[model samples]
Target: MPLQKSPTGTWLPARVPQSTITLAILLVLCSMVQSTTGGYDGSMLNGLNILPPYTDYFNLNAATTGLNTASVFIGGFFGPMAAGVMADKFGRRIAIFWGCIITIVGVILQTAAQNIAMFVVARVFIGFGTAVDGIAAGVYLSETFPSRWRAWGVGLFNDFYYVGALIAAGITLGTGKWQSTWAWRAPSLFQGIFSIMCIMILPFVPESPRWLIHEGYYEEARTVVAQTNADGNPSDPVVLTVYKEILDTLEWEKKEGRTMSPKEIIKTPVARKRLLIGMSAGPFSCVVGNIIASYYLTYELDTAGVTDSTDQLKANVVLNVWCLGCALAGTHLVANWGRKGTALLSQTLLVICLFIIGGLSKKYADNPNAASNSLIYGNVAVMFLFQGFYSIAWTPLLYLYPPEVMNYSIRANGLAFSQFMLNALAVLLVFVEPIGIVNIGWKMYMVNASWDIIIIVLIAVYWVETKGRTLEEIDAIFEGQKHSTVPDVEAVRKGEATVNLAELEKEVAATALIVEK
Candidate 1:
C-alpha cells in the first residue's frame, strides 16, 4: 500500500497503539546491545591509546598500535564464515546467546592480558563473537518488527552504538588519571557488559517470524505477526494481510526450490544486483573518511593541535553525543527523504566537509600557533561535522538496507557476506589510516573525498528506494511483477481492496521461468 499522511501532515501514521510502541521499544533496546558493544570497543581503544600507562605498558608504536586495534576486525573477518550458517540453522536467538558467550570469554582474556600477543588474541575472540551476535540481532530486528516499525527499529539498533561509545568515553575519562594498569584493564573488562545485557534480554523477545515460517512453525509465525502488528488480535485485517503476504511469498520461493547456499545469492541478474547493493553498505560505511575519526580520534586531534590528553578524551565524548543526536534524526529523516535521498544528502555534505577539513589541516596542522588556532578549531569542527553526517546515513543504513534488500532464503548468508566485506576492508583501512595520516597529513582527506564522489554516482545510478514498503512487497520490484503479494490492510478491512492470487501465481511462475532461462 502507498503511504498515508497523518493528521499532523507527516508520513507517519497518526497514532500507533501503545502495545506496538512498547514492543518496538523493548526489541530495539535488546538488539541495540550488540552494536553498543562494538561502539564501546572502538571508543575504549581510542581512549586507551591516549593514556600513557596503556601505551607505555604495551610499548605500542604506530605499527603495533594499528595491529592491536585491527585485531578485532581480524577476528570479525573470520566470524561471518560460520555466523551465517549458524544463524540459519540454529535460530537467531541461539546464535546471539552463543555469540555473547564467546565475547565474554574474550573479554576475560583481554582484561588479564600478560602481553601484546595475549591482548591481540583476546580481541580476536571479541571481534568474532561481536560479528556473530551482530548478524543474528540485525536479522532478527529486520524480520521480527511490524512493517511500519521495521526501519525505525533496525535503524535505532545501530544508533545505540554511539550510546556505547558515550558510556566508554565517560568511563575511560574517569579512569584516565589512575596510575595502575587497571586504568586500561578496567575499560577492557567493562566491554563484556553489553553482551551480557543482550543475553538477559533475549529470553523475552520473539523469534523472527520469517525464520519461524521457514522452519515450518506456521501457527507460531502467524501468532508472532499478530502479536507484533495487531496487539495479538489474530483476525485483525493488518495481521491477516501481512501474514498472508509472508506465507504466499515463502511458498512461492519454496516452490522455486530456493536454497540457503551463499552461491544462491548470485544465481540470477536480479539476485546479483541485490548482492551488490546490499554488500555496498560495508565499503560505503568503512571508506567514507569516518574511520579516521572513529578509530584514530586521538591522532586526528593531536594533528589538529588538541594535544592535551584530557581535551582529546573530552572531544571523543562530545563527538559521540553529537553523532547519537544526528543518527536519531537521520532515522526520522528516512521517512521523509527516503533511503536514497538521505544517503545522497549525507555524502554530498561529507564531501564538502572533507575538503574544508583538508584545506584547514594543511594550513594549520604543521604549525599550531596562536594565530592559526581558530583555523585549527575550524578543522576540528569539520571533523565533528564529517562524523555527524556519516552517522546520519551510514550508521543506520549499514544494518537497515542490507537486510531489506535480501529475501529470507539468503538474508542470513547475504548479511554474513556484507559483514565479511566490512571487516575485511576495515582490517586493511583501519590499519592503514594512521600511517596515511602520518605520511600524507591533510591529503588523506582529499583521497577519501575523491573516492566518496564515485560512491555517490554509483548510488544515484543503481540504488532502489525501499521506503514505505513491506519486505515481501519489495520483492516485486526486483522480480519484474506488476503487483506485490501484500494486500492493502486498511482497504482490505474496508472491503475496498481485491487480491488476485491466481494472477499473482502466474506472475511468479513467469518470473521463475525467466530466471531459469
Candidate 2:
C-alpha cells in the first residue's frame, strides 16, 4: 500500500500522552546535565603544564584526560544500540529506568576514583547510561504525539539541553569548584534524582498505543488512544477516523506488504533509501562543526603561536558565546525555510568563517600577540554567525527528520538505528579529536572547515526539505511528485490532512520516474 490521505482542511484532537511527555522531559533533562559532567576534562588535558590544587591526584596525564572526554562517546556508542534493542523487545520505560542505574554507578565511580584508570572507566559507564535517553526519549515522544505534533515535540527536546547547560554553569560557578573534578560530579547525582522520579511515576503513565497493538493487546491500545484523545478537542470525523487509521497503520505485519523484516528494510528501495537518508542525517546532525565547536576550549592556542593566555582565553570564550547567536537565528528560520535550504545557508556561513580564520591564523602566527584585535574578533564573531545559521537550519530540526522519512511501523526502530550510528560516530570523533589537536597544530580547525564545505555541497545536492509535512505527504514527496499536501501552519485544525494536492500529484509523478528507472 502506498498511502491514504484525508482531503485538505482537516484537524482533530492532538495526541500528546501526558505520561510520555513528562517522562520525555525528565529523560532529556538527565542527558543535558549528565553531558556537562565532563566539562573540566577537556581543560584538564592542557593543565598538565601547571599542577592544579591536586596536581598529583592519581598522577593524571593528558592521555587520561583525553580518555575522560572521549570515553563518553565510546560508551554512548554501544549504549544506544543496546537500549534500542531493549526498547523494541521490552519497553521504553524499562530501558530508561535501568539507564539511570548505570549512570548512578558511573557517577559514584567517578566520585570515588583513586586512580586515573578508574576515572576513565567510570566515564565510559556514564556514557553508556546517558545514551539511553537519546533513543528512549525520541521514541517516547514519537509514540506519544499525534502525527501533526510530532515535530514540535521533538524540536523542543534540544531546548532542554540548553537549560541543562545553564543549570550546570550556575552550579559550577556558584561553588567556585570548577577547578575541581568534583564540581562535575554534582551534575551526575542529579541524574539519579531524575531517574528515580521518572521511575516512581512511570507506572501511572500508559504504554504506547501503537506498541500495545503491535504486541496483540487491542483492548489496552484502544483504551490508551481513546483516553489520550478524550483529553483534547477532537473533531467528529477525527474522533471517528483517528483510531481506525491508527489501527490500520500499525497492524502487525506477517509479510512484505503487511509488515517488513529488518533485512528487507535495508534492501527495499524505499526503505533502504530512507535508512540511508537517516544515516546521513545522523552524522551531519552531530558531527564536523558542532562537535568541534563543543570542544573549542580543549585545544591549546599557545602552540598555534598565541603567546598571551588572556587573549586566547577571551577569544575562546567569545567563540563559544557567539554560537548562541547562531542557534537563535536557527530557531527562527528552521520552520520558515526547508531543512535543505536552512542547512545550506548555515553550512555555507561556517565554511566562510573557517577559511577566514584559517588564513588569519597563518597570517598572525608570527605576531604572537596582536594588540589591535580586528580580524581576531571579527572572523571569530562570525563563528557565532556560523552557529546561528546551523542552529536555525540543522541543529534543532534533524531529530524531526528521521521520523518523517519512515512509516509508522518502523519509525521507532529507524530513529533508534540512526541514533546508534550517531553515538558511534561521535565516539570516533571524540577519540580522533585528541589526536588531531596533539598532531595537527592549527590543522584541526582547518580540517573541520573543509568538512563543513563538503557537507554543504552534499546537502545542497541530495538533501530534501521536510518542514510542515505529513508522513503520507513525505512518502509522496520522496516518491518524486512535484507537490505534496503538507501543511504550513504551526498547529493543525481538527480533521485536516492539510496537504497540497498539486505537490502531491507532482511528487507522485516523480516517484513513478524513479521506479521506471
Candidate 3:
C-alpha cells in the first residue's frame, strides 16, 4: 500500500500483507541467531574469574580471553565470503537452511566444550553459521519485499540482533549463580535456539522472486509475486508492475552483457559505491568504541570501580535494554527520517556522548575518590546514551543501507564483501580492545570520539537517500537515469498511471531534477 502520513509526521505504508510480515519475522529470527551468539560471547565476559560468578571458571587472562573472542570474527570473516557464492549460486533458501544446521552443531560444541580449544573452535562454527545467515537473510529480504515495506523489513531484521543481545544478558544474569560449567554453557546452548526457530520457519518461506526472475524462471517469479501481493491475486497490477520492472532490468542487463560477478561489480563505479557504503558501515559502528563496551563491559566497568559481577551484569542488562529500545525506535526513525538523516543525527549524538563519557571516565580513572563516583555515574549514564544513539541509526543502517543500495544481480556478493570488511575490523578490535583497555584505559574513548566526526562527514557527503523509493527506482538513481517519482505504491497496485516506467522516465528526464548524496 502507499504511505500514509501520521499525525507525528512520519510516512508509513497503509497496509502490509501477512506474507511480508511473516517473511520479515523469519528473516529477523535468522539474523537473531547470529546476534545471540555474539551476545553470548559478550556476556560471557561477565562470568570470567575477575567478577562474581567468579567461578575462577575459565581461569584465563586478558590476552587469552581476547583470542577466544576474536575467534568468532575470524570465522565471520570467511563465512560471508563463502555464503555469498552459496547464496548466489545455490539460492537464498538452501544457504540459510544449511547455515542454521551449521549453527546448531556449533552451539552443541560450545555447550559441551571440554577445553578452551574446543570452545574456541565451536565459537568459530557459530560465527560461520551466523555470517551465512547474515548474507542470505539480508539479500532475501531486500529482494522479496515491495518498496513500501522494504525499510521496515530491513529495520526489524537489524533490531532483532540486539534483541538477541538482551536475551543473552538476561540469560547471563539468571545463570550467574550456577556453580558448575552450566553457568556459562547454558547461554551458549541458547544461541542455537534462534537458528532452530529459523530452520522451522524456512519450510513455510518462499524463495526470492527477483532471484527467480534473474534465473529466467518467469512463471515461478510471477507466481511468487502474486502470492506476495495483499490479496494474493496473480493478476494484480501491483504484482505485474513489479514483475515487469524486474524483467525490464534483466533484459537491459542481458542486452548490455554487463557481468555482475563480484569482480565485475567492483569494477562498475556505481556498483562499487554500494559495496563501499556496505563496507563503511562496519568501521563506522565498531570504531565508535561500542565494540569495546559491548564485549568487554565487565572489564570496562571493573576498571571504573564497579567490580562486582552481579553489579556488572545489572549494568550490562540496563545498557542492553537501552540499546534494544533505541533499536526499536530506529525502525520508525529509519522509515521517517530516511537513512542519511537518521545516520547523521545518530552519529552526532554518538560523538557528543563519547566526549562526555571519555572526559568523565578519564577523571574517574585519574582520581578514584568518592567525588569521582559522580563521574563514574555520569560516565555510565552517557555510555547508555552512547549505546542508545548508536542503535538509533548505526545498528539498523549498518545492515539495512548496504543491501538497499546494492544491485539485485550482485546483492549477495556485495553483502558478503561488506560483512568481510566488518569482521576483518572486528577481529582486530576484538583482540586489541582488551589490550587497549589495559594499557590506555579511558583515553580509548577519545579515539572513538575522533573517528565519529570523520564518519559523520563521510556519510553526509556520500550517503544517498533511499527512502520511499523502489529497488528498481534506486537502480535508476545510481545509474544516472531519470525516473519519475513513484508517489504511492498502492496507486500502482490499483492500476494507476504511475505504473509505466518508460513514460515515467520520459517525464522525469524532461524536468529539472535534484539529487542528494
The number of the candidate with the highest TM-score is: 1
Candidates 1 and 2: which is better by TM-score? Answer: 1
- Model 2: residues with Cα > 4 Å off, grouped in runs: 1-61, 175-184, 187-205, 226-236, 251-264, 300-332, 478-517
Per-model TM-score on C-alpha atoms: 0.91, 0.76, 0.88
**Can you list the residue pairs that collide in candidate 3?**
463-517
Q: Candidate 2: TM-score?
A: 0.76
Ranking according to lDDT, highest score first: 1, 3, 2
Give one digit per residue, the lDDT tens place, for model 1 in 63-101.
Answer: 999999999999999998888898888888788888999
Residue 152 CA error for candidate 3 (Å)?
Answer: 1.1
Better candidate number, 1 or 2, judged by lDDT: 1
lDDT of all predictions: 0.83, 0.53, 0.71
Candidate topping lDDT: 1
Q: How well is each residue in 429-517 modelled by candidate 2, as lDDT tens digits? A: 76676567667655666887887777877877766677665454465565564122334222323534454445444443443333223
Q: List the residue pairs that clash in candidate 1.
A: none
